[model samples]
Target: MARFFVSSDHIEYDDAGCAKNVLIKGTDVRHIKDVLRMSVGDTVTLCDSCGNEYVCSISDICNDFITTSVISAARCGSEPRIAIVLCQGIAKGEKMDFIIQKNVELGLNEIIPVLTEHTVVKFANAKDAEKKQIRWQRISEEAAKQCGRGVVPIVGMPDSYKNVIDRITSDDDTSTTLYIMPYENETDRTLKTVLYENKDFLNEGGSIKRICVFIGPEGGFSKKETEYAVSKGFTTVTLGKRILRTETAGMATVAAIRYEIGD
Candidate 1:
């Protein structure tokens, strides 16, 4: 069965009756009726974006939306216990797009486009940045749908490195928190070393709840910037001996963390 995400408001209850309804609006109507050719009685899964999945069967297809009766509902189990937020340095062209798509598939919780010291991409204005953010967010939603993700990961507005540091540290608890920045300049400290050493955070059979990974743009973070991040409690580490592209670094770190922390 095909799966889709719907806002909680799209769900309605029949007060006088017992049959709850799942209504799908907007472009999904066309997808169900025209593209998928799914008719009344066809089954589909609808997510409420709150980690809940509804098994619904189409009962009516109207001009504006598709209405279905809920067959059953269950909490979504595809989401990882850990929430990994990717603080990606905004790269030029479609690099951010690829980054968002792949990271969503890899179970990232959210993405923040950061303006690092060496970031080359600059928006024309606020309007331009807003448009780009919208586009990237849509890419995340699409990727989530394809990968059976229960909730679409949000692509947050681009922020400066300093702003990101402040936002991350504001609510972080030192004892359990893990904030990492993968840098090319760092050689002695490796990602594996840090993850393995932090066994306290990842206790036996206990999953990590919060992790933040930072990846620089093409030119990478400047020495002054790296030092500033390190000062802000971010553990600067390397992926390995070889260098990886800006886009690859985030995904690699996400996968490694998932493996080390037990996805």
Candidate 2:
């Protein structure tokens, strides 16, 4: 079955305000009608970005829209219970695009690109920043759709190294967030061992609220920056004996975590 995500407004209500049918509009009309060549009575999956999903059947297909009658509705099974946030050091060219796509497929909850001391790319103004953010977000959305993700992971505006550290380590933070930074210099604390010691697995099972992984640029994070991050409670861990590129580190860390705790 094909899957799509829509806003709450797409759901139609009965006289008593209960959901009756789903109204799919815009470009998807052509996708179902022409691209996929789906017809009435075909089954499709729809999710209202809030996480509830419906197994719907096409009842009518019009030129402007498609109507789907609800067959069964339930919480999306694909969404991970433990969220993962990737704080990536901005890579140049198509590298960033690859990172965005792979991370979304790995079930990341959010991705933040950061500029560090060795960053190769620089923006002259806010306009450049906004445009890049939009493009990256679109990549994330498309990847989510392609991978059958229940929700598209966020690709946030680029931030500075200091800003990202502060953003994740604040007391006003409602969600339980744990930080992991992979450093080549560190040989003692492997990511696997650190996660096992720091995370819950016995009483509550291997349940993590959120895991934030930081991957520095090609030159890697400065010693001062790594020390400051450690001072702010970020754990410095190792991937292994070998070194990984800026793009490879985030995906590797996320995949390992998902293997450990993700259902």
**In TM-score terms, which candidate is top?**
1
Candidate 1 — which pairs collide? none
Candidate 1, which segments miss by more than 4 Å at Cα?
A: 13-19, 172-176, 204-208
Off by over 4 Å in 2: 15-18, 62-64, 201-208
Please, what is the whole-model Cα lDDT of each candidate in the order they appear? 0.89, 0.86
**lDDT tens digits, residues 153-203, model 1?**
999998888998888877745445688999998989999999888866676
CA lDDT, candidate 1, residue 60? 94
Provide the global lDDT of candidate 1 against the true structure: 0.89
**Which TM-score value belongs to model 1?**
0.93
lDDT tens readout by residue for model 2, 1-263: 88877778989878976667998887778988999999999999888877788889999999998999988788877898878889999998999999999989999999999999989989989999999999998899878888888887999999999998888887554246677899989999999898778656411444447778899999999999999999988899999988999889998999998886634
TM-score for every candidate vs. truth? Answer: 0.93, 0.90
